[model samples]
Target chain A: MHFHVEVRNLCKDYPGKRALIDVSFGVERGEIFALIGPNGAGKTTLLRILDLLDEPSSGTVLFRGAEVDYSIKDRKDLRRGIGMVFQRTVLFNMSTFDNVAYGLKVRGMSEREIREGVKAALELVRLQGFEGRNALALSGGEAQRVALAQALAIEPELLLLDEPTANLDPRNASIIEEVLSRVNREGKTTIIMSTHNVFQAENLAHRIALLNEGKIERIGAFQDIFERPHRFLSEFARLENVFSGFSKATPEGTSIIDVGNGLHIEAAFERSGSVIVHIPPEDIILSTRPIVSSARNTLEGLVVQISDLGSIVKLKVRSNRDFTAQITKRSFNDMKIGLNSKVFLAFKASSVKMI
Target chain B: MESPFIEEVLSITLLSLRVSGLAVLIGALAGVPIGTILGFKRFRGKRTLMRLMDVALRSFVNTLMGLPPVVVGLVVYLLLSSSGPLGPLRLLYTPTAMILTQLIMVTPIIIGVTMSAVGGVEESIREKALSLGASNWQATWMVLREARMGLLTAIIVAFGAAISEVGGIMMAGGNIRWFTRTLTTAIVTEVELGNFALAISLGIILLTMAFAINLLLTIMQLRGVRG
Candidate 1:
C-alpha cells in the first residue's frame, strides 16, 4: 500500500534538547502504525507537531502530498479534519453529550446533524445511555471512552492517540484496543498511536517503529521487528522478551542442550565436558505431584507463590532449580493450588530446543 | 433636642448618592478594560506599566485618605480661581467638580482590583480554549466571564469609596445646600453649627449607606463562591 504520510528530514529543537532529529518515515495508508519509545524519546513532541498543535523547527510533514502549516490562515479547517485524543482524558466538565458534540459545534454543523452525529458516535463506543450524565462523574475507563467518542464524532480522516492505554487497567486496555480495531475497520481512518507498551504495539499495530534518541532506529512489520530485530535494538527489546540460556559439551562430540534452566545438562551434543543450558519460560509446566508421564523432564518443586492475573496464573516454583510456569486459572483451580504447594512439572524433550 | 432633621438628611444623602454614583459609573467604564488588557496581554513594558500603576494609585489614595477637608476646599478655591488653568471651565463650586475629582480618586482602585481578578484565571483553562480553536479574543472574553464576579467586586469597592469620601466633594462642591451638599459634607456642616442632634442623625444615615453598600458586596462575593 502507498503511504498516506511522508515525513522528510523532520527536526525540532527546544532549548537544550533536540526533540526530533532528521526523522524520516512514511506510514502506509490504512495501517495501524505504532510509534514506540521510552520516556523523553520525543514521542509526544513528534505527535504534537504532526497534529499541528506545535510547529516544527524544520523539515516537512506531507499529509497526502501537502505540507502541514499550523500558522496558515486555513489552519482551523485543517485541524477540523484531524482528530486527537490527548493522553490525559480531556473531557469537558459538562454532560457526556456536550463533550462529543463540541467538535461538531465548532465545525459549524447544524443542530440536527450534531444531535444525530453525537448519538451515532456515542453508540459506536457503546456509551448509549450516558449522554445526560456529567463527564466528571465517570470512572477513568469511562472517561477515556468518552474522549474516544468525542474524537470519533468528528469523522476525522486521521486519528492520533497519545498513549491511549497508558493508565488503563487490563480489562479497560483490552476494551480500548477492541474499540480502536472496530473504528479502524469500520471507518478506515488512518491511525498513528504512540505508546511505550511493546506488547500492545505488537498485538495491535500493523507496523511498529522503534524510536531511540529522537531518531527512528527500526521500522517493519510487528513480528519481523520482534523476530529479527536490529542488533542494537534487539539488545534492549530482548529485555522484555526474555529467554533462558542453556548449552552442553561431551566427549562423543559437541552438542548444545536446551535445559530448562541456566545450567549445563550433560548431553551427547558437545565434545569434552563444558557446556551451558538454556530455557524459555513458556516451555515450563507445573503440577501438584509426580505423575507417571512419558515426558523426559519432570521437576519436583514447592510453589513459592501463586499470582492470579485474570486469564493466566503465574506459579513461582523452587525445585532443586528455580523456574516459572504460566497456566490457566481453570487449571489452577482444578489442582486447588495454594501458597507453598508441592508440585511436579513436565515438558517434552522436544520442548527444549537447543540454541 | 431631636428636631425632625430626617428630611434634611435624606435630601443631602440623595445628593451624595447622585454625585458618587455617577462617578462610579464613569470609573467602571474606564477602569475595567484597562485592567483586563493589562492582566492578560504581555508586552515589552507590562511590568513597568503595572509598577507605575501601583505606585501612582497607592500614593494618590494614601494622600487623599489623609488630606483635611478644609485643605481640599482651599485647594479647589485656588484651582477654580481666575488664575487657574481650569478656571475657564467655570466648574468651581459646582457638583461637576466634585464628581470629577471623585472619579479620578476611585478609578485606580477599580483597575487594580480588576487586574488581580483577571490574573487569577487558570492558565489551563486558557490553553484549553485555544486548543478548541477559539480566537484569542474569544478566549479572552471567556476568561473574563470566568472572572466576572471578581470584577464586580472591584466595581462595588470603587462605588463604596466614592460614597464614603468627604474631602473631594466638600472642596469642589462648596457644600452648596440643596444642590451639592452630600451626606458627609452635610454632617460636617451640621456639627460646625452646634446642632449635635441633627449632626448625629446625618452621621447615622451615612453609616447606613456604607453598611448597605458593604452588605451588597458581601452578598455578591458569596454568590461568586457558590458558583
Candidate 2:
C-alpha cells in the first residue's frame, strides 16, 4: 500500500515541555485522517510540522516517499504540493476571487488558468457567486470556505487542516465538513485534520489518531477506535459507561464491587485485580427504579452534568465509582434528567467492553 | 500706539515656514528607516534602544518645540559667526541654517509616529504572511504596505509641524526681506512693520497651508481605515 504521507518518530520540544513526542502515523492516499486531542495535546504543532511551517526537534516526515526537507530552499517544491488551512482563517482583505487566486498567482500560474482554477475551487466550496465579495465580510463558515478554496486552488496533494470547525455553529460546521468531504472524495487529496468535535471525526475520518499528553495513545479505524478503545483512549473519546472496580469471587464465580457502592457487578475477566469497564454511553439504560433483568450490571448514580454534543447528550453520571453514559437527547428529555437527580444506570453484560 | 514694523512680521512668518518645512523633509528621510528597524527587529537591547530613543527624542522635540525662534537664530548665528568652529562655511544667516534647525526639531515626531504605525501591524499577520510563503523581505513589505496610510499620516503631521513654526526661521534665515522670508517669517516681519494687511494675508496663507496639510492627513487616516 502506498502511503501518501508518513511520519517517523517525530518529536518537538518547546521551552519547558515536549509538545509532540515521537508521533508516527501514515495516511494512505484518499483517506481522511484525524488528529484529535485537547488544547495542549500538540495537535496543531504536529500539523504545522508536517506542513513545514515549523520544524521538529528530531525525526522525519516523508511526503510521497521523499524525506521531508525543513529548509525553504529545499521544501518549496514539497510545499507546492501541500496546502494547509489554518485554525484561524486568514484572507487578505480583498475579494474572495483574489483570495483564492493568490496562491496560484504566487506560484506563477497563468492568468487564464488562475481564473479557471479559482472558479472551480470556489464552486467546490459552494462559494461560486461570492468571488466579487470582500473576503473579510464573509461569515465564519464562508470565510473558512474561502480559506479552503485558496488551498484548493493550488490543487495540493496533501491538505492539512487545524481545527477547521472549532469556532463555527453546528450548521456552519456541517457545511464545512460537507465541503471537505466533497473535496476529499473528488480530488483524492490525503487529508489530515485536527478536530475538537468528536462526531465530526466519526463522520469524516477513515482512521482516527487519538493524541493525549503529546503521545499517540491509539490510532485505528474510526469504528475500531470507538468500539474497542484503550483505557485512556476511551476516556479521551468520552465513551459512555467507563467505570472501574475491584474483582471479588462469589458463588457466581467472580464479580467486581464498584468501590463506591457495596453491590457486586459480574466480572468478564478471570484474572482481575483493579479492572476498568467501558460501557458505551448509548448502551446505558436509565430507569427510575430497580428492574429485574439478566443484563448483569446496574449502578446507582446521581446526574452530575448533561452536555449537548449535537445529536447526543452526554450524561456524566457520578456513581460510588464514576460512570459516564451517552444517551440520546430524546432519551434525556424523556427521562427529564436534571442535575443532582438520583438515577439508576444499567447496561448489559455484553455491552460493557472491558479493556 | 501705532502698529509696529510690517517687515519683521513677514520675516518671522517666512522664517518659520522655511526652517520647519526643511526640517520635516530631512527628518522623514532619516526617521523612516529608524522607525522601521525599531518596529521590526528584536535584539538584546531593543527595548533599551527604544526607551533611549523615546526619552531622548521626545525631550529633544519638546525642547526644540518650546525654544524661541530668536534663541535658535541666535544659536545658529553664534555657530556660524566666524568665531565658531567652521564658521567659514558661512551657513549662518542662510535659509539652509533655518532649514537645518527645523529639520532637527521635527525628526523626533516623525520617528515616533512612524514607529507606532509599523508596530501596529499585528504579529499574527506577520506570521500569516510568513506561512504563506513570503520571504522575510516580502513579509516586511507586506507589513509596510498595510501600514502605508499610517506612515503617510505621520509624514503629513510632521510636515504640518514643520511648516507653521517660526522659531528657527528668524534666527537661522536672518529673515532677509523678499529673499529668505517664507510665509511665517514674512508675516512676522510685516506685523513688526505695521503692514497689517500684508501680515494678515501671510497669516491667512500660513493657516491655509497648515489646514491643507491637516486635511490631507485626515484623508490618509480615513484611507488607512478603509484599506
Candidate 3:
C-alpha cells in the first residue's frame, strides 16, 4: 500500500546535541498519527522536518511514495499542501478575519474565495463573530483557534499540529480535539500531531509512536502497545512506581521477587531471574496501621513527602523501596498524614506486573 | 500683516518649509529601502557583515548624526562651486543646493532609524509568515508593515533634523532673501542685525511648525499602535 507520508532514517544534529536519531515512520492517508513523548524528546523538531519548515541532517521524506525535492520552488509547492500549527500560536497583528485570510491571500486567491474560505474555517473552529477582533488581543484559547482557522483556510492535504492544546483550558482542548477529528473525518486531511499527554494520544490517534531520547521506542495501535508494552515502555508508562528485582516461581504457581533491602514482592504471574516490576500508584492502598488483608504485598514505610496536587495528594513513601501513591486530599486530611509519618502500603499480587 | 517685515517673515518661512519638506521626502524615498534590506536579509557571512557594520557602518552613521551642518555645507559648496567637479550644474548658492545639503544631512538619520525599527520586529514573525506560505518578498512586506510606526517616526525625526539645521543651508543657500533664507538662517541674520523682537517672533513660528508636524506624526504612530 502506498503511504501518504514516509520518513526514513531521519537524523537531526545540532552543534552540541542530537535532536533526532535515525527516526523512521509512515502515515497512511486519512489516519491520525501521533508522536507521543515527554519534553525535550525532539517531537517539535521532527514535526518541523515533516512540515518542510526545516531540513534534516540526513534522511528522506517521501510523499505518495515520491521523494520530496528540497529546492525552494518544490518546497513552496509542497508546503501549500501541508498546514502546520505551532505549539505557540503565531498570529499576525491583524484582525481575526485578516489572520485567517492571510494564507489564501498569499496564494493569490480571489477576494470572494478568500472571504468564503476564511468564514468557513472560522466557523469550523467555532470562532464565528470574531472576524473583526484583533488577533493579537485574543485570549490564549481564542488565539489558538484563530491559528487553526488560518491553517484550515488553505484546506491542506496534510495537517501537522505541535501540541495544539498544550496550554489551553480543558474546554478549549476538547474543542480543538473535536475539531481535529471532524476535519480528519470530513476532509480526509491526514493528521499528524505531537503531544506529551499519553491519554490524548490514546484518545485521538489511530496509531501512536512512543518517543524517548530522540528515538522511537515503539509504534503501534494504542491498545496493542499499551497492553503488551516493551520493557522501556512499561517503565515509561507506569511513570511513578517501577522497581528492579529478581523473580522466582514458587511451588504454588505464584512468583516472588526480591526487590532489594530484603523486601520480597509477591506477584500472581510466574517468572524467573531478574525482572522489572510496575505497581500502579492508584492500586497501592495507604494506611497508618498494618491490616490483615488478602493483599499479598504489605510493605511498611515512612511518608517522606506529601504534595497536594489540587484534588489529589501525592505521597512519597520510602521503605525498602520508594513508592509513589496518589490519594484523595480529603483522605489525606482525615488521616492527618505528614512528613516522616509511618505508613503501610498494601496491594494484591495481581497488581504487580513483571516486565 | 501689511508690513514689509511681515512679508519678509512669510517668505522666509515658506522657503524654509519648501526646502526642508523636499529634502525629507527625497531622503525617505531613498533611505527606507536601503534600511529595510539591511534589516531583514540574511546570507552567508551575514554575521561577519553585521559585525563589520556594527563596528564601522553604524559608527559612521552615528557620527554623521552629529555632523556639523557647516561642514556638510562646505562640502556641498565645493561640489557646486564653479571650479569644482559638479560646477557644470551651476547649482551653487541656489535653493536647490540648500535642499541637497539638507537631504544629505537627514538621509543617514532616516536610514539608521528605519534599520533599527525593522530590526526590532521579532524574527519569528518572518519565519511564521514563511511557514504559512508567504514568499520571501511577501514575508518582508509583512515585516515592513509591522515596523510602520518606527518608519514613520524615522521620517518625522529626519524632518525635524532637516528643518532645524542652519549651517549647511547658510553656506549652500547664501541666505538670499525671498529665495533661500530659511527660518534658522533668517533668525540668525535677524539676531546679527540686532532685531531681537523679529528674531524672537521667527523662533516662535519655527517652534510652532515643529510642534504641528510632530503632533501629526505622533497621532499617526498612536493609531498604528492601537491597531
Candidate 4:
C-alpha cells in the first residue's frame, strides 16, 4: 500500500506535560486528513511535528515511504515541499505583495517569476488589488486571506493548517474552506488540518482522527468514530463556546441555563430541564471595561489568551466560565488589554443557539 | 552674522557633530550585529545555562548603560595615558580620545536598544520564515529587516546621548579652544563665565537637533508601524 505520510508510536514530552503518546496514523496520497480534538488535546503539537518544525521525543515518521531524518543538515529541502498556516495569523510587516513573495524570493526565484507567482496567489485568495496594501493594516479577514496567499504561493506537496477557520467570521471561514477544497481537488496536494469543529471536519475530510488527552480516541470516517460515542464527543468537541446543564424558563420569554462552575448563560429560546447550547465566537463582543448594554448576558472576564488574527483579535476570557470573544484589533489596542486584564463580554440572548 | 563669537559657536557645533557622529556610526556598525546574535540565539538542551547567561548579559549591559560619564572618561583617559597599555599610540588629550569616550558611553545604549528591537520580532518572525522554507540565516535576516524601525530608534537615542555629554569630552578632549572644543563643553565654559546669552543659544541649538530627529521618528511611527 502506498502512503504519502505515516507515523508510528510518536511521543512528545515537555517538562511535566505529555503532549502526544504513542500516536500512529497513515495518510494516503492526495487526500484530506483531519485531526479533530478539543483544546489542549495535542492537535497543534501533532501538526507541528508533521511539518517537521518540532521533533517527537520518540517514534518514526515516514514520508513517501522513507523515514524522516530530523538530524539531516539539509532539512530545508525537505521542508520546502510543505506549507503550513498557524492558528494565529502571522505576516511580515511589509506590503502584501512582498509578504506573499517571501517564499519564492528565498528559493532564489527570478524577479519576474516572483511577481507572477505573487499575483496568482493573491488572485487565488480574491485579493487582486491588495498587493500594495500594508499587511498589518488589512482587516482580519483580509489579513488571513493574505496569509493563505503566502502559503499557497509556495505550491507545496503537503499543506498543514491549525484551526484555519475556527475564529473567522462565517463569510471568511467559508471562503477559506472553499479555497482548501479547490486546492485539494485541482492540485492534488495532500492536506492535514486540525480543528475542534465537527461541522468543519464533516465538510472537508475524507478521513478523520479523533484525538483527546495525548492519544487518538478513534480514527476513521466521521460517523464511524462517533457512531456510539456521539453524545459524549459532541458535547464539548463539536462546537465553540458550548455549554450543557439544566435550564429554567424565565418570564421574559427566555431560558437561563445553569451551566455550573458558578455560571448561568441566558439563551433566547425557552427550554426547561436538560439542554445544550452554543454561542458562535463572532456573535460576542469584547470590551476593556464594562458598559450598560441591552444584551441579556453581561459577564466580566479575565483575558486569559489573545490571538492576533490580522484585523481582528480573538480572546479567550475566563469569566464565570471560559468564553471566547472577538473584537477589532483597533479596539483591542485602544483598550490596552493584556493577559490577565479584566474585560467584559456582552452578547444578545438571540445569539445563543440550542444544539 | 559673521561676528567672532558666532564663528566660534559654529566651529564648536561642527566639532561636536563630527566627533559624536563618527562615534555613533561606529557604535551602530559594531553593536547591531552583537545585538542580533544575542537576540536570536539560545543554548538549546541547556535551558538553565541559557537563562543564566541571558541574565548575566542583561545585567552587564544595564550596568554599562548606567556607567558614570566621568568614570568612562577616566577609563579612556587612563587607557591612553603615557604609562598605560595604549600609550604608544599617543591619543591622549585629542579629539580621538573624546570620540573613544563617547563610543564607550553610547555603544551599550545602541546594543541594549537594538537587542530589544530584534528580540521583540524574533520568535514569531523566525518561525514564520522557517515554516515558509527559509534557512537559518534567512530567518535571522527577516527578523532584522522587520525591526528596521527599532534599529533607527536606537541610533537616534545613542546620538542624542553622545552629543549632549560634557564631562567625558571635557576630560578626554581637554576642551582645547580651537581644536577639541565642542558645543557641550563650550556651553559649560560659557555658563561658568556668566555668558548667559551664549549658553542659552547653545542650549537652543542642542534642543533643535533633538527636536528635528525626534520629528523624523514621529513621522516614521505615524506611517502605521504595528509592532
Candidate 5:
C-alpha cells in the first residue's frame, strides 16, 4: 500500500525545550490515523510540521514518496492539498458563506463552483441555513462546524485536525467524529487527527499511535494495543491497574505473580520471571462483601479514595498494592461504597494480562 | 447681505480646503502602500537589523509628525525661491508651493499611523489566510481590509493637520489676498492689520469646516465598527 505521508526522524526544538524527538510515522492512504496522547505530547507540533505551517528543526517529510522542498512556492503548492482544523477554531471575521468560500477563492475557483462546494460542505457538517450568519456570532459548536466546513470546502486530499473537539461538548464532539468518519468513507480523504481522548481514538481511528514525551511509544490497531499494551501506553491510556512482580508458572499452564505485600495475582498468560501486569479497570469487580465466585483472584482492600468521573466512579483501592476500579454511578449507589469502605475486588485469571 | 467681507471669507475657506484636501489625497496615495508593506513583510535579519531600521524609520516619521510648520516653510521657501535649486520652475509663493508644504507635513502622519494600524492586525489572521492557500499578496490585502478603520483615522488626522497649519503655507504662499490667501493665512493677515472682527469670523468658519470634516469621518468610522 502506498503511504500518503512519511515523516522521518522528525525533531523540533523550541528555545530550551524539545517538542518532537526523533518522531517517525507513516500515514496510510485514505485511513483515519490518530495520534493519541495527553496534553503537551507534541501532537500539535507534529501536526503543524505535517501541515507545513511549521518546519521541523531536523527532519524530512515525504509527501507521496517525494521529499518536500522547503521553498515559498513549493510550500504554498503543497499546502493547497492539505486542510488543517486548528485546536482553536479560526474563522475569518465574515459571514459563514464567505469563510467557507475563502479557500476556494484562494484556489481561484469560479463563483458558481464556490457556492456549490460551500453548500455541499456545510450540508455534510449538517450546518445548512447557516451561510448568512456571521461566523463570529455562532455558538462554539456551530463555529467549529463552520470551520470544518471551510476546510472541507477546499476538498483537500489530506485533512489534518489538531484536537478538533478539544473544548467541545460531548454532542458536538460526536457530531465532529461522525462527520470525520463519513468524510473519510465517502470522500476517501486521508485523515490524521491528534486527540487526547483515548475513547475517541478507539472509536474513530483505524490505527492509533500512542505518543508520550515527544516520542511514539507504540502504534497499532486499537484492539491489539489495548490487549497487549506497553507499560507507558497502559499508563497513558488510563488502563491504570498496572503492577510489577515476579511470576511463576502454575501446574495448570497459568502463571502466578507474587505482588508485594502478600498479594498474588494469577494470570492466564505463560510469562514467567519479572513481568509487568495490566488489569483493565472494567474487568475488576468491586463488591461490599466477599463473594464466593469462580473467578480466580480475589483481594480484600480498603477504598482509600473515590473520584466521580462524570457517569462513572473511579475507586482507588488499597490492597497489597493500589488498584483502580471503575464502576457505574448507579452501581456505586446500590453498593453504598464510599471512602474507607472495606471492599473485595475480584477478577478472573484471564483478565490479568502481562505487558 | 452680499458683503465683500463674506465673499473674501468664502474664497479663503475654499482655497484652504482645496490645498489641504489635495495634500492628504497625495499623501495617502504614497503612504498607505509603503506603510502596509513595512508593517507585514518579514525578511532576513528582521529580528535585528530590520528591527533597528524599523525603529529608526518610525523615529524619523514621528519627528516629522511634530515638525514645526515654519521650519518646513523655510525649507520649501529655499528650495522653490528664485536663484534656488528649483528656482527655474518658480513654484514659490503659490498655491502649488503651499500644497507641497502641506503634503510634506501630512505624508509622515499618514505613513506612521498606517504602519501602526497594519501592524496591529493579529498575526494569526495572516497565518490562517496563508494556510487557506492565499498567496502573500492576498494575505496582505486581507490584513489591509481588516485595518481599514485605522487607515481612515490616519487620513482624517493628516487632513486636519494640513488644513489648520498656518506657518508653512504663509511663508510658501506669501499670503497674497484674493489669490493665495487661505483661511489660516487670511486670519493671520487680518489680525496683523487689527481687523479683529474679520479675523474672528474667519476663525469660526475654519472651526466649522474642521468640525464638519471630523463629524463625517466619525460617522463613517462608527458605521464601520458596527458592521
Candidate 6:
C-alpha cells in the first residue's frame, strides 16, 4: 500500500529565501496528481527534489517505498524510471529525431529500438515526421512538443512537469493536456504536474495540491475543497473581487454577508459567521449611472483603471471597495466611459461563489 | 613557375601546415576534455577546498592562454636546451621543437576558447540530458556535442595563432632552411635579408593556406548549424 511517491516535510532553502517550507504530499501509482499554485510557490523546487536533480534542504522522499539516494554514483536505473519536463523547453541543437532519441540512446537501446521509441513518442505528441527538422528552429509549440517527445521516448514510470502548459497557445496546450491524459491512462505513468491553471487540474488531475508561499496550503479534489473558502486559493487561482465577511442566513434560504466598508454582499448560500467569496468579473454589469434591477447588489463607483484587452475591457471601479468589472470593449465604447466616470456595478447574489 | 623559389615557398608552406596542424590536433586531444570540465563546474554545494581548486585551475589556464609567443619560445628553449631537463633528446633547432613550441602556445588558446564554448551550452543541455536518463559522462558528452561548433572555432583560432607566430618557432626552431623553417619564419628571414619579392610571395601562400583551412572548418560548423 505504498504510495508511488511520497515526500515528508520537504524543505528547500536558497541563500536569501526559503523556496519550500515543511511540505508533505503523496501520489498514488498511475494517478494524475497536480501541484497548482501561483508563482514563487515552490512547485518547481518540489519537482526538482522529486526528480533528484536538487536535494531538499531537509526531508525524506520515498519513491515506490525506497528512499531516494542522491549521493549514489550509479542511479541511472532509478533516474530512467522518472522523467521531468522543465518549464522552459530546452531541446538539444540537433534534429528532432536526435533530440527524442537522446534518452533511449543513452540507455543503450539499439538504433532500431531508439527509432521506434522516437517515432512512437513523436506520434503521441502529434509531431510525427518531424525527424529531420532542427529542434531549435521550430516554433515555440513545436519545440515544446519536441521536448515532450524527448521525455516520452524513454517511457518512464513517473513524469514530473513544471508548468508544462504555462505559456502555450490554447491549441497546443490542449494537445499537451490530451497527451498527458493518454499517457496517464494508457501508459500507466504516475504524473505529477505543477500548474496554476485550475481548469486544467480539474480536467486532468485526480487530485490537486494548492501550494502557496513556499508551503502546501491544501490538497484535495475540487469537490473536496469546494466546501472550504481559502483566501489564498482564491487569490492565486486568479479570482478577483474576493471579500471576507460575516454572513447571516436569510429566511428565504439565501444569505447576506456584510463585508467591510458598509458593503453587504448577498450570496446564494446559507453560510453564517465568516466566509470568503469571489464575484466573477464578467458577471458584474457596468452602467453610466445607478439603475434599479433584480440583481442583489449595485454599488456606485468611479472607474479608477481601464485595461483594454482587445475584445474585452476590465475596469477597476472604486466605491466603498474596489471591484473589477469585465465588459466587452464595444459596450465600454457605447457607454463612452473614461477615467473618473461614475459607474454602477451590478451582479446577482448567485454570482458570488463561496470559494 | 620554373624558379626554385617556388620549391622554397612550397617547402615553407608545407612545413608550416605540418607543424601547426600537428600542434593543433595534439592540443585538442589534451585540451578539450580539460576545458569541458572547467567550463561546466558548478559552484553550488561544493566544498571550499574544491572551490579553491577550481579557482586555482581556472586562473592557471587563463594565465596560460595569454602567454606571449616570445615567452613561450623562451620557456620551450629552456626546457629543450642542452643543460635543461629535456636536453638529452636534442630536439632544439628541429621541426619537432617548432611543433612543441606551437603546441604549448596553442593548447591554452584551445582550452580557453573551448571552455567558453562549453560554458555557453552547459547548463541547459546538461540538465536536459540528465533528465533524459543520461549518466554524468553521457550528459557531459551531450553538452560537448552541442558546443561542437565552439570547439571547431577553438581549433581554427589555435591553428591561426600557431601558423602566424614567428617568435616561438624562430627561437625554438632556429629557422633552419629546408628543415625547421616554416612560412612565417622564412618570411621573417626573407624580409630581414632584403628579399621583398620572396617575402611577399611566402606571405600570400601563408594567407591562402590559412584561408583554406578556416573555410573548410567554417563549412563544417555551418553544416552543424544546419543540423
DockQ for each of the predicted structures, in order? 0.18, 0.24, 0.50, 0.35, 0.41, 0.68
Q: Candidate 5: which pairs clash?
A: none
> Could you tell me the interface RMSD of model 5?
2.1
Tens digits of per-residue lDDT for model 3, A1-355:
8899999999999878899999999999999999888787889999888877778899889988989776654355678888889999888878999999999999999999999999999999999999999999999999999999988999988999999998787567777888898999999999999986555676689999988888998899988886644576654543667788899999999999998888899999998899888887778999999968999999899999765544467789999889988788799999999999999999999998766
Model 3 lDDT at residue A66: 88
Which structure among the candidates has the greatest TM-score?
6
Maximum-lDDT candidate: 6
**Which pairs clash in the backbone of model 6?**
none
Superior by DockQ: candidate 3 or candidate 4: 3
Per-candidate Cα RMSD to the true structure, in Å, reads: 7.2, 6.1, 5.6, 10.9, 5.7, 5.6
Q: Can you write out model 2's per-residue Cα lDDT over B34-140, one digit (the tens) per residue?
A: 77765663421436776787667546644544455456567777887779874999887777877776766667667667777887766655555555555566657
lDDT of 6 at A145: 85
Backbone clashes, each candidate: 15, 48, 0, 1, 0, 0
Q: Residues A80-168, candidate 2: write the lDDT tens digits.
A: 77888899987775688977887787677899999999999998878889988888888988998888888888888888899998877
On a 0 to 1 TM-score scale, where does candidate 6 land against the true structure?
0.84
Query: Would you list the C-alpha lDDT of every candidate in the order shown?
Result: 0.72, 0.75, 0.86, 0.85, 0.86, 0.87
Scored against the native two-chain complex, candidate 4 gets a DockQ of 0.35
Candidates in descending TM-score order: 6, 3, 5, 4, 2, 1
A162-186 per-residue lDDT for model 4 (tens digits): 9988778856877788788889999
Worst 10 residues of 4 chain A by lDDT: A227-236
Error of 4 at A116 (Å): 1.7
Tens-digit lDDT track of model 5 for A60-132: 8988888977665536688888888888887776789999999999999998999999999999889999988
User: TM-scores of the models, in the given order?
Assistant: 0.69, 0.74, 0.82, 0.78, 0.79, 0.84
DockQ winner, 2 or 5: 5
Locate the minimum summed-lDDT window of 10 residues in model 3 chain A.
Answer: A229-238
Give me the runs in candidate 4 sitting further than 4 Å from their true place.
A230-232, A239-355, B1-8, B41-46, B216-227
Q: Mind giving the per-residue lDDT tens digits that candidate 5 earns over B7-97?
A: 8778888999999999999999998987787676452143677788877877888898888989999999999999899999989989999
Tens digits of lDDT, candidate 6, A260-334: 899898888897888888887778988997779999888999999876543567788999889989888799999
